[model samples]
Target: MGSMEEPSPETNYTKPLGIRFIEYIKRSNISYKTHQVIVLIVTFIAYASYHAARKTTSVVKSTLDPASDEVSLNSLPWRRRPFSWILGDGWAPFDGSDGTVLLGEIDVAFLAVYAIGMYFSGHLGDRINLRIFLTIGMVGTGVFTSLFGIGYWGSIHSFYYYLAVQMLAGLFQSTGWPSVVAVVGNWFGKKKRGLIMGIWNAHTSVGNITGSLVASALLQYGWGWSFVVPGLMIATIGLVVFLFLPVTPESVGVSEEDESDSPKKSGAEVTSPLLISSRAEVKDQPVGFIEAWKIPGVAPFALCLFFSKLVAYTFLYWLPFYISHTAIDGQYLSDAAAGNLSTLFDVGGVLGGILAGHISDRLDARAITAASFMYCAIPALFFYRSYGSISLTANVILMFITGMFVNGPYALITTAVSADLGTHSSLRGNSRALATVTAIIDGTGSVGAAIGPLLTGYISAKSWSAVFTMLMGAALIAGLLLTRLVVAEVTAKIEESRSRRGSTSRSQPAVIDV
Candidate 1:
């Protein structure tokens, strides 16, 4: 028998359908700048759909376990103790005396699994076709998200069923951040990453607002539609992603290395040997999980994000419920109104993310910028808690400010900071570590995201004030975690200023020269 020969370097192999489409686009003369724009828009929409699906559960929470007469009965002047408790009228399993605790457990179960899946997802993202990975995640997320809502139409109230669906949804949702960030990082360099990512990060707030509005509006039809609509929307968007997303520049035969050095933004250059060697090296020696964590600034940023996400996710999950239950002008709001009003918080978050990104870019200090935002969030939280209930105007104003401070660091860390660390000079231009680093940081933060809502569920039953206290404590610690990094940034700035001054003085003509 004749021995089989290995494929030659010049031999053409069967490419995936997505890659073939990308190659077709390349041959049709699309420019590099156009491809970059496509990358940004596709990723932005893709991740936004993920957030949109996640937001449905929070909006529908009120309908699931509504406030009972116990709340109104305790509101009377004659009552000794104001009994703010969940009564048995809610859906089974969640309506029992331990209903609130049970609800919190669902959040814990979903996030715990999400956190664990994140680690593995990141590892897999590095090795697989990101386009396929992301599409599977989005489609799976839609299926599971819809299943949770189907329970309503089916008249199913088993706690375990809903819990299982949510947990599975989280596992799929875990595929989003690492994949999107890694793809975006591959396209854009660090030149203006903070501002670019900041603007792009607005997708999160936009998705939340869209989800809240959609879900709240559909509540009149049925709470089931609230979840089902967003679920369908994401599934549809997933199809778009599968068709259009270019996972990396190379996937379409565009060399990012050549683009980086090219004077014009044309795609006429062939693949350079340096680019090929770099890719080969990365494929052979991908960064390990432990090694990614060991990158300078990774640990501090990861720890800071832990506390940052705790505060952010707590508000994401419970702010609507808190607003509905708390009296504004001695009147209670309907669940729909509360959900609609909650969009203001996300509106503020959009501005905060943009501002944080611009400031970090201008200052060239990611750590200091993020730490400052976390510090400011402390006062914002206190003010919102103290004065937010006075009037509708006050509530909107204070909640907006609170959201700005709270989400600024979160946006900065998850985007610009994560990208910066992922491509640290220490990596020596091997870009394989980007996904792994992103995963570890976000995965650690997901643990805090899990803890926050879980604690808020139990603490809110006792006192809302205690929940604020916990958030404030988390903010303070988040800022403190970045102290060393902030100092380093400050020192680097001072040295740079001195060096510029010395160069200016030397360059000036001497007045005493003949």
Candidate 2:
């Protein structure tokens, strides 16, 4: 087996200070189990911080364009609109009548670039050291996130400035999901990946919740602080990730003996026939984009996720605005209150992700689990849109349910499903495909993510009902996309069950007669 010391002299020279620190730690008497735990915690916090920063824009949107019926800036005795602002009302271009559409455009700019960048970043992640790739992404994301906030204090209202910053931030954000998923997949195998990743995936909702609370809390001070604080947070966590993240077992000199003993505790079955054979001979070549797309389940799951993300991200970016604009029991919520309330959706999402993962693992059927979630989300969306305005309790309950169903398949596909496809048997244990496959699936989904928010902006001006209809239709389509795969899994499961029963009968009858 090759040792960590086998890298070229140039590669060693270019190693970050964090990699050196990790090497120093590895010299100590640490167990493989300890290293596994650290990987989980560090990656969790790192990605969560990324989401937290991404979420700031959504929470602060209402403050950028306060509703006309609400108390105006002029009504406040202590506060006055700044003279440098283009409009004496709210923030310039964004505060205008076309503000919602502009907001949607900004979302499209960010997510469109994000979707495009994902393809390249995935390829890069497979070739380069993941720790370095991930750290650079987080830091870049922080810088751009803060730059968006800096525009407020600088009295700069150029629409292009915000648009450009968002575009850059999206590019950086594209690095996060693929890198982290690849790292986790490196450490774990397919034994119970769905359930394990499902619980781990809570980081997404947790980050959203944290971002909403933090941004909402700071809205009273200034909208800029909302972005600045989260920006600083992700940047800080990036430093921590650079310091301690181990890219793979081989990188830390974990012995073969340690790996053999570690899977039981780690929930990874490292001894699986495929993995065992693959690890026997190291393949330096990574899978190409065209090759990854050719993998059997990859294309269908990717398409399903496209529609799935459309529904989920629409709510992610615009739900707070919707909550604040629409009345609940004849009362409209303040920006902060609405932002805070929007977190219930993510709260339900956390649970839904875990439940979906557990069900998929138990059934050993990823497509069936994902498709069912999408089917349920249709009714959930309808109920929330129709009855959510009736009362606060009803709104919360319906919204939570809607979030659960909408995010369930999304969570399953992005994490467990992507990992599974990346490590499919046809690859013959070529683990290098993990990042590229993950990128293809998620990159395709991001296109829909961009479209969802962009369309919501235009459609919302007409009627919120139309928006609900679009979401429900998307959810239905998402389920339909998975039908073929779901049927295959069902048929395979039936055959396996019959084989097991036949084996049990054959093994028991002869001995009983004797």
Candidate 3:
């Protein structure tokens, strides 16, 4: 019905049918606050759908290639049980001896493609109508995801077919994060960004929990249902998004009311729209990917996220399979039980993201908050590995705690921190770098995410303890990478406190003489 890219502030793009209808009904009564609410709701569900699709493979892993026995160190060899809850023989090709390796290959392939695609997606998102870009990505993702499930019905055992579908799905999935984050950044200011984005970022965990529950519940009917349902859900939501998603404040003729919206310096020739009270300049072009990365804090945060996302994504892709294979109090869980149980981790992640974001906002120091969370994760990982199998209750508690600590920094880095950097003061007044900056940081992290699962797939076969060790080490590295940034934040705070005290003493008019 329309072109892909929205026209600039100098020109008006035709509004979507849904938006045109909305404006006609509300007319001048519509307020900026109302638009903010709409933006949050739409973006939240949109990204959540993306995560729902991403989490399906994890839940379906044990079903695709059930093993004959438990690999836990505590279990007696004779006490072993079959891995699959429903599929006795498991799916062919994947059921072979090399099945585990094949699954790992699929994980790496999908993640690698996703990581590569992220860089390009960000660059493209800035220049296009974010709504259209996001819609095409979601629909394409749905198509590929459903195709993976359709293989089971078609009785297709070709490993290459599944691999191809997953790789394509990953590429489409890359379009989601940069698009949603940029949209949200465009609407809200940086004043309460930490708390707001932290709460908003829960979409990731919410999506995960939804995927796990839906995929797990549907597993008994068929493994194929897991992927197909989430696939359909995201595609449907994508259409809703296309109809209603306003890409910018100007899109809806509203103004941002925060200081961050004003330009600190000048760069772009155009001024913010009269309807939108922003500091932004209408740049003739979007920021280049490499130029966005050159912003002061971008590289370090990107590197830090590399390790942070590694630890988080490891649990995301493997926790269900790990739970199904390991015994809790000498009893192994069914595939469904494990899949359902894994939701607790994401439940905890929801808290962690909100907590981390709130803390960062309150402290006004993103680095310190993120680093602290990463450091705490080391102990949580150790405790979970050492004591989680003692009982189901213990496992749940430890898993939730581990998830909280592990995902806290990851959520922070990807959300509020990315937004802050994208709109860095150095950008002058240019507001076009949000998607690019988000892509650079997250794309780097996606590489680590891919490596973690691939490594876990192999390491778990030899010894699960070793996998925990790797995760702990990664968490440590993540925290350590932020050392310089954390130190700088601390130093700045100390100097500010001293300066405030000095000013107070001067204003007291000779307290010592009194």
Candidate 4:
């Protein structure tokens, strides 16, 4: 009571306005937990959209009745200049040789263009406005996805037209990962990111399941409808992201992690909606391409991702065909049944990813978790080769296990570890380079993605055993590469701690939130 009369002038002057606001939150128990949930949901939608668009091609091929498949290039009624000359100016062509070739090219053409576009799309996302870029990308992807279905409705038979659609569709698909990874990286920190991102990224597997279910349902009625469902779904989700998806947390007034500890409003602080343009504008130092590549652990990590993706994509493209055509002394699954069964792979993949994430989070060793799972997958791949001859049930079980192990590492290394390396403390606390860093890794991975399916197609055309051997080699190589990254990370942490303590035994610096 005596001291109240002399209320300290200095106490009022030094008290922070920001601290009071923070205290207000605690007193009311206000939390961003709701916002985090919304972010995850939207992110899931975006990833699902990507898979829906990607999986339509598989469905279309699956439902094709080999009995009804006829070559009609020459007999087509168009009577175009090329057709007239080839058919002796009056007689329609006798055989449909050109038709099959054109059809074959259409699918592979899409894959070729997709690999090329992935390399450059990340740069576009970083340089342009995210909302506009993502919106346009979604629209383009959806339109092209629908076009394939529309072609069937229109009775379109020109192979060239489908090739064009596939190429354009592939181009649009490139927009997904670069943009999604950039936004997600901005939302989270390196702390427990492996676990968090692992769970979050399971949308990849979920999308695969959703797409398979939708595709299988439609294939029984009309294969064309398969493409339309996914296309419309993507368009619908695009609208939601346009209306509600925040570019970054800062866009909503929450301070980014880098700024959470500092009260002063430094120009260097990253703000949100975590959009790439905003990131570029606010970062203290923008990393160059050369600098990003030169980072100690980045190259090895990128190589690991490349090889892992190679195996994953190979399975994605070829598994249904294998089950339908080569299963157990040619006792094959019907087209619809095969498509439905492969969905189980993604089901297992989702569980595997979540488990891997949680384990890595507790141990704080993404490399070890990734490597261990891949190594475990080797036996399952061998199991498929052995029991694949025994019974359909055994084959399905083995394939599901293979999917779980392979996809776990694929999701973890690409999302969680990429973010960690991208925002490593060596960057002078700038997290703005996430898009570029992720692009470099995934873009390099696209090379392997391009190679894997083509190699599998050719190898399976020869002997399925060769395909198994190739996948095994890829998994082993990926594990070795990640082992290198684990060593580098540990060494870097030791060096950093040493730098904080003086030669005379001073206290070590406190570890920052990852």
lDDT of 4 by residue, 1-514 (tens): 2122221454323323332343345553122454466667777788788887777665444233221122111111111222222223111110143433454566567766776676567666666655556767787888889888786568676666777888999899878777777777777776767777877887786786677568656754455687887988887777766665555555444444333555344556554455756555556355667777776667877898788889887777666556666667457666446646666777777777877888888777788888888898788788888687588778778878988898888888778777777777778567666766777788777778778877776687678888999999999998888887678657866876787665436555666896
lDDT of 2 by residue, 103-193 (tens): 6568778888999999999999988989989999999999999999998899888888999999999999999999999988887777788
Residues 264-361 of candidate 3 have per-residue lDDT tens digits of 23433455477244444445369998899899889989999999999888887677678887899999988658767887998888889989999998
* Candidate 2 regions with alpha-carbon error over 4 angstroms: 1-27, 62-101, 217-223, 255-282, 324-337, 389-391, 510-514
**lDDT of each model, Cα atoms only?**
0.81, 0.83, 0.83, 0.68
Best by TM-score: 3
Q: Once all C-alphas are superposed, what RMSD does model 2 give against the true structure?
A: 5.7
Kindly provide the TM-score of model 4 when superposed on the true structure, using C-alpha atoms: 0.76
Better of 1 and 4 by lDDT: 1
At residue 361, give the lDDT of candidate 4.
81
Between candidates 2 and 4, the one scoring higher on lDDT is 2
Clashing pairs in 1: none
Per-residue lDDT of model 1, residues 1-514, tens digit only: 2333232333213223554465555554344676689889988998989988987875565456554222321111111211224212356665566655566667678789999999888888887878889999999999999999898789898999999999999999999999999989888888789899999999887786677678867766777888899999988888887887777666665555454756435556667889878777865467888899889999999999999999998888777778888898778777557767877887888889889999999999999999999999999999999989899999999999989999988998999888888889898877777788899999999999988877886798899999999999999999999999999999999999999999999999989857
Candidate 4 whole-model C-alpha lDDT, 0 to 1 = 0.68
Better of 2 and 3 by TM-score: 3
Question: TM-score: which is higher, 1 or 3?
Answer: 3
